[model samples]
Target: MSVPISRLHVSHDAPLLRHVSEHASRTDWCYMHADVASAYHPCFSERLLQQMLQTQERIRRNLAADPDPKAGIHHLVLASDSDVFNLGGDLQLFSRLIRGGQRGRLLEYAQLCVEVAFNLHQLYDDRVHSIAVVEGDALGGGFEAALCCHTIIAEEGAGMGFPEVLFDLFPGMGAYTFLTRRVAPVVAERMMLDARVYPVEELLRMGVVDMVVPRGEGRQAARELIRRNQRIGNALRAMNTVRQACNPVTLDELLKVTNEWVDAAMRLNDRGLKTMERLVRAQQRRAQAAAPALTLV
Candidate 1:
């Protein structure tokens, strides 16, 4: 059964989440739309993560094998529900991983998500337009995922931010690099460091989101953008030319920066882990206490 966005989890089975395992494997321009019906519950299930890794590997192989690369996919649009895009990783599971001394596994999980983010970025770099239709809250890894896309389209009521600092942690995914690329460094810094939540208008002002559509028309607006881009054949190739002409930092270098942050997160075991544990516990208590009042409807 499809769980409510507030109740969904990686551990909880939903056909859509299970379907993500097979999404990246399909070649020939995947016009993907992510409508995470249940937003707050982001489990990062073992099965789904494993499948995502496999699918990514398949994409890499396909990209490498293509003798003549061409622009594919009209565009990939990730759609969200009425209130939020994604609430991010399931903190309960994360706390379990941390408490169990499964740092290696946790890092591996984070790295897989990192790889996915980079792959998405490369797809955009190659001229395949990827759009994020954010209708609700997009926090932590969810925000990182949205940043990986080429364009972000949100509705008027949307909220986007990174609030992981409260848990004594940071977004181990590609939030740092992606945010810096999409918006000004100062704005990204404010978001990450201050854990500030930006409203739709504010995000638009900063140029983080390309367009703000009507409340329920985010998906339609995104597809329109994709269709417009599709009219230009070899879109990705043209974008690559511009990138080369501008002499921007290479993808390999960006990956290096992302990995350095991962390494730092991995090193947070001795004192850092203990500190994080306390912080997370306090947060969990507050969330648990407030759960009944935090209604989605």
Candidate 2:
């Protein structure tokens, strides 16, 4: 059985939850499900980013306090409570900030996002493994977030892409760096420039998604993977360490890219901003309809 972290009768106080719900698994892992309050947009709002940062910090503190690696969280799985994994950044906020010429606010938001992504990439510590369970669409920054995880287990029929190009912007968070690390640079560039949603099958073939299970089986797949990895925990950890060492994505790199993203965002003309607004409207319509459709280009 799983217990909500907040309700668990433990020695330590539970981490606060607003845009995310966290649970402790009986199988020796932590399960984090994203339940963004802004259903219409379902993006990573400022509050959500802050909450995630706090959650990660708590996890790190716990691991540090316990010298026994087995006593602490072995695997961290991230999934969404809604039909969509995540739609991406707060485009509505982005539009408002850009239109108002609030470049500083935009940079701040981008930096926060980078921090979250960087923390996930490092997995707090090498002993812990991070997995992203994408059971639905993950677009733009959302895709970047998933790519930061050590392993990506997606469900069939799920869609993912970098739709920022549709608004004449690229996914500046970590899409390019993460994708290039997994696949070829040309493939990453094409995916970004194409600006169209790709099916999970195509993503799996392209080496973007690590595993694809049947729809609605994402959690089970993740659990099974976690159990298997746990059996060879030491070996798995060492492999991940080698992987990270071989293809390092430093904090400096992510921050530099975020700076570029801020510059590009400020350069968006009225037409581009209007396109972004249209996408926001489309997201709202999808939310109201209660459909699992990806925003079209």
Q: lDDT value for candidate 1?
A: 0.58
Candidate 2 per-residue lDDT, tens place, 190-285, comes to 998898899999988888899999998998898888768767887866876797788877878888999999999999999999999999999888
Tell me the whole-model lDDT of each prediction, alpha carbons only. Answer: 0.58, 0.77
- What value does the lDDT take at residue 13 in candidate 2? 27
Q: After superposition, how far is residue 211 of candidate 1 from its true place, in Å?
A: 0.9
Candidate 2: C-alpha lDDT:
0.77
Per residue, candidate 1 scores C-alpha lDDT tens digits across 77-178 of 555422456666655556677667676656556655666566655543453455677877777777887887778888888788877776556675777677
TM-score for each model: 0.71, 0.86
Q: Judge candidate 2 at residue 243 and give its lDDT.
A: 79
Tell me how far the alpha carbon of residue 162 in candidate 2 is from the true structure, in angstroms, after superposition. Answer: 0.8
